[model samples]
Target: MTTTAPTATAHRSGRRFETARQVADAVLFEGYVLYPYRASAAKNRMRWQFGVLVPPAWAPAQGEHSLQRTEVLMEPRGAATLSLELRFLHAQRRTVQEAHADGTFTDTPALHLPDRVLVPWDEGTEERVELRVAVPELTEKEIVLPFNRPAREDTEPVLDDHGRTVGRLVRRTEEAEGVVRLHAEELEGPYRVLKLTAVVENTSPWTPDGPGTAREEALPRSLVAAHLLLGLTPGSFLSMTDPPEWARSAVAGCANLHTWPVLAGEDGRADVVLSSPIILEDHPAIAPESAGAMYDATEIDEILALRTAALTDEEKREARGTDPRAAAVVDLAETLPPEVLERLHGAVRSLRAGTGAAAAPQEPAPEALFTPDTPWWDPAGSAPAQPTPDRVLVDGTPVGPGSRVTLRPGLRRTDAQDLFLQGRTARVEEVLHDVDGGVHLAVTVEGDPGADIRREQGRFLYFQPDEVTATEEP
Candidate 1:
């Protein structure tokens, strides 16, 4: 797409990708999270959730809510219709009771559980729910779908193994979906920036008003996955997943990524990158300098195959006993050759092993955006020297220095400066404790330490306790 806007002033165009292809390539890139980003991580693997957005009620006490807004600079092709396709997983609450062979009570059923354990609750269903698209930059804004549902009653008895009478699980729900539209006139400026906001409300109906203490007033909600697609005039959208060339030229200037309307190029092409609302920053779970980080994990496929080379009949049965989601991985590990697992141990070493403290800082690779001191899984790369209170936990992990983190889109500091673009990873440098005992963190780019400094402080960038998460490893 070409723009007639004058390039009289040479500025960084926030534009990183000219098409959606570029955005997809970067977001779905390898190691974007880690080698085993999606693995069960039950035994010895990494499980990453870089782009997860949960409802406020379900979110950790110190974590951000599901509300999200992204600012993007778009040159609409003459009042084009912008379509957005959102995908997410819906979570429903279920009262769970322990089962016994005698079919007796194993204590009162629990209302809420901390972690998302699939065994107890119903299988999560992926949802493409719609919401009213509100843009403060536009002329008109309103909710496309309003909450409306007739009250009804439904109840299921919570039974025991003996098939006896127990408490009831009652619920009511109403759901609807629609699209919000914006006209060219609603958009402003030759370089129009539309602030898209989506407010997901509790569509589920409240518990039936009746006697008995098994009442559930709250309803179920969904969690949005990180990946989102904004449909614009054929090729009108450009990708801003990475930094512009102009911003990369200066060591200190690169830190300006938190600022927007970055002059992408001389063609008046600019890109505005949005950050994740969730903070993935925290100390590493694994110890720094641990052997797990040093081993050549590239051989993982071969090692897993070798370990499962000879699965015993008994071991195969044990594997099937595990969670179905993780049965395959368990099967491979159980039958893996002991010799192979032992031999592969400690085969990897730190990428910074030989570099001395005073060693000159190395330049980032041409395609690199944020450079860190070590790989994501390495203890040194994730763990903090000084620990802080555990408040915001991502995927059940805390935020700490050396830990890799993901920022929410349109994130801002107290002064309203962009925190960092959403859907990317950054490394924690240090965890700060205020006089009030509030916890914060100082973080830097994954591989680019140069981008770590705060332009305002001339030092590392600091974020709130919930601004980041350790969920997304570097």
Candidate 2:
């Protein structure tokens, strides 16, 4: 069998495989809610997806209804903030990258994916998030991700960012506050050879790939953002009747976690079931408060206020900083949340005894396009079909989208004097076109219920079919 080589970008250097060789079944799972599939919708909008069980017994229609969800119990230390997002998408197995980087290599990058999936916001609502803290212990929990994999080739048991060879995720599990525990880890990356028996347990809260929730208030400024967002119930158990044995000293994410957690327990061991690798990015942060029965709206605002107060010094200097509506994260004392700081205070000192803050500010990931940060309705209208010059004859009839025609956001070429009020969030949804079917500009000063009535959503903000910076939050 003749094998091929991969390009520089794909290789990332470690592998020497061909693109075609790497080609396999890719199962993409995306979650959405009740909102338009526009570009700027939020993540959790109450939408329904197919395949998921939405028994007609549950709904009147033949389609699957909105996914089911539950408010998982969370317990954090002092001044903790929590934001729970419905799992957007989760998958059990996927035809993924081979065990080795390529035929020449023996192991991979030690990457592991979660069995459960969770995608919160959509691509509409100018939704923004922030993590802020002022008190001694400010813990902002983000998202929960769970992953497990069969072992393949191991290394010299190389060390990773979080330390140790096995990549592990440290989270909170105890009912009592101020406890940060290591829930799970990617001691196993992907496998080159599975027992053909490894199984990834998958569960519910599956939303759809359609519309998401609406009307999001981009988090306010002065908020400190914490990234850790996984919750684990302490004392959980992992029982394996006849689990496969470890290949080598397999490790990638955290060195502490194990597929078969315990070997001496009568039943098995304690472990957490997760959909994906829990992430601490892009969740909301509010005023300081203790964990309560429900998320108090008043408390939400109070956090917003504290965040604002904290940003007082920086606000006047930056645009987003000054934007009262924008959100900002404070970078004070400990890089990790305060609780993690205190609890792990002793443990972390040892973890950092040999290292510096290099891990704190890791390389910034490539900015992801097609996210909520992008424009909701970015159009392919830049180089529109140029019409027949002016009042000339197109087979002698008087055609074209119209001369000096204003094609507002939602207002199509329906006729004259009719405004299409379909512009969702920011203003200037459409545009005005010239007689030759060419757009000239769009409506800018609209939408806000303030001193700009005539300047409706998509009325005056016009451009030469190129300036589509409509309704942008940032």
Candidate 3:
């Protein structure tokens, strides 16, 4: 029932920051199925050093708790390994006997004392998610991410045409932690020391429960500090053992949530750009990119210092009243500058601006939201969904959808290669279009054994002969 905050003289240690996971995010597939990924700005984040409650480079409490993301670049090109960074973030809510001694909260939330984190908790701050890969001139080699960054359970499925279970959708997910780099314009050579910032948010509205008042507000502020020290996006393949050689060894870090990125812009004040992809239907077929760049930063700390200079010790304050979370909001409001205040004031406006034109109306999910005819993120025939007219699926598994197929297949499967496997490799042998104008790939690959090789090679798999380069490979 007592606060676990570090002492005042130990302010620096209050957050107890830790590990900044740094690795290459390369991917390879085994068979002939095309890999899946969303390419754009977010993917290029090779440096995933941010977290919600932990600072970059902090060590875990004699345990294996850390933040991580597994990756595989599917489109545009293929890669061999998914090397990124890992740093532990907070885990399940611990039983803080004291915080709940008086029994004020339904559950006593853990305090993420990171020096900083990306608390993009306001209305539209959690607007996007994306993936990209940029080889610093230092390496001068292409980087790819194989292995699916485990998807989070946040956005919910809205109503379908008939108000039934329409395509599943997740809104500003609290589980989101994406990479953002201070993109370097130069191509090769002396690499720029990138400042990658991963953003996190609370999709659940600000209720009296959970992180109440004082604690609530401090959470976002902590996030601002957290992103600086570390990034928290559960990687693709944190599996204890690497998947059947087919699947590349996923970068190791946090194992639960999904996503990672390269971030930049923070000497306290820096420009920021938030981006993500549009995953339509359960079948992730298309990867449309979305980005919103803006020049925003914490108001010169000194400005708020004079006012909130005395409020720094509040993260440990007890939650009082029916809605203690409100107190934190008020504390943050007091320390906030005009700009952030404006962001607070126009939060709704900002949200509207952030959601690209494609954001579906908050009512019946529109079928036209994405390409009315295009397949979803999972492709056609995947489980939890079905192949619509003219559309099909292509995963490591043999042409099936919604199957628990593991792309890491050296083992035999009566199941289709498309159904199982975390990653895969397949080629577009021929383009097939039905009279209805649907698209499909008549693929080819060596049978059984090929499945094994395909998994390993899948992460780096890409279509060489799309049109002009339809038969090209350098």
Which residue runs of candidate 3 sit more than 4 Å off their true CA positions? 1-70, 74-217, 224-474
What's model 3's overall lDDT?
0.25
Candidates ranked by lDDT, best first?
Answer: 1, 3, 2
Alpha carbon lDDT of each predicted model:
0.37, 0.24, 0.25
For 345-415, candidate 2 gives per-residue lDDT tens digits of 11111111112333333332222123234442325623565543333322333322222222334333454
Model 3 C-alpha lDDT per residue in residues 1-474, reported as the tens digit of each score: 111112101122111111111111010000101101111113211112233332222213222112333222111112211112222222111122112335333322222222211111121121212233332321342222111122233433323246643223222223223232221122222321222222333222223323223332323222221222222122121122222232233213213232432221221111211111111111111111111111112233233333333434432132111112223433454555655443322111111211334455432222233332433343343356443432234332233211222133323334463344324434443444554655544333324456455555553222212211122222
How well does candidate 1 score on lDDT at residue 449? 45
Q: What TM value does model 3 have? A: 0.18
The weakest ten consecutive residues by lDDT in model 1 span 280-289
Number of the top candidate by lDDT? 1
| lDDT winner between candidates 1 and 3 | 1
CA RMSD of each candidate after superposition: 20.0, 26.3, 24.1
